[model samples]
Target: MKEVFLSTRDFPVDEKFGLVSQILRSAYSVPSNIAEGSGRSTNKEFARFLDIALGSAFELETQLILASDIGYLSENKLQEIQTLLQEIQKMIYSFKMNL
Candidate 1:
């Protein structure tokens, strides 16, 4: 989340309400959903939240790709973010399956 914010700080002013906003929302959504899910009373409910988090992770990945395509992010930076996002997605999936 911090990384997303930091990276977007360099984006064009026009993107403050565009790609940057979308990217930040999606990036934060992943963790927020996960945290929300963890507090659910039932495993099923938790799994549902994890599902949402996973979806957000995928959404964030797409936004990152779009940013790269637009030259807002470098290949290296995108790769770094992608790697971390993938790990988070995998962890969420695994935890959900166990639930």
Candidate 2:
């Protein structure tokens, strides 16, 4: 998520509050949901939170693709982020499955 913020630092001022904001929110949601879900009392509740996190990961993935298409991110960078997001989603899914 820090990478997302840093990458958006050079975005146009107009986009600062647009694509940049969307990317940040979605990226932040992934880990934030995980942490929140971990604090829940039941595995079922935690799994629900993981589901939300997965959704956020998918959202982030889409935004990153948009960012790349719009030239805000380089293809290589997008690939890197996509790889990480996939890994995170897979880990979250595995955990949720165990629950």
Candidate 3:
């Protein structure tokens, strides 16, 4: 979402091209992959794409932790975002598995 990109601009400048970039890209990839997969004709292909999206969600989760640990992001500031990402990951995984 464009809203996420707008909000993440508040992250430290040092992370602009590092953690910030990684986090945004990975977060965006999850939904994008899901959409692209839905556009496919086959259930198998859609499931595969959902799996990739799920993986990206996990990747973003790790990056979030790293950013907070390294002080590029505040623990409290990222807590809600981290929780949301985990929820999305669970939803994505459940959908993918049911496919």
Best by TM-score: 1
RMSD after CA superposition, every candidate: 0.8, 1.0, 1.8
Considering every candidate listed, which one attains the maximal lDDT?
A: 1
Q: Which residue pairs collide in model 2, if any?
A: none
Q: Rate the local accuracy (lDDT) of all candidates.
A: 0.90, 0.89, 0.82
User: After superposition, which runs of candidate 2 have C-alpha atoms over 4 Å from their true positions?
Assistant: none
Model 1, range 1-99, lDDT digits (tens) per residue? Answer: 677778998999999999989999998898899899889999999999999999999999999999999999999999998888888889988988887
- Residue-level lDDT of model 3, residues 26-70, one tens digit each, is 988999999999999999999999989989988987987887787
Sliding window of 10 residues with minimal summed lDDT for model 1: 1-10
User: Each model's TM-score?
Assistant: 0.96, 0.94, 0.87
lDDT of 2 by residue, 1-99 (tens): 667778888778899789989989998999999999999999989999999999999999999899899998999988988888899889999989988
Q: How many backbone collisions does model 2 have?
A: 0
Candidate 3 clash pair list: none
**Candidate 2 worst ten-residue window by lDDT:** 1-10
**lDDT-superior candidate, 1 or 3:** 1
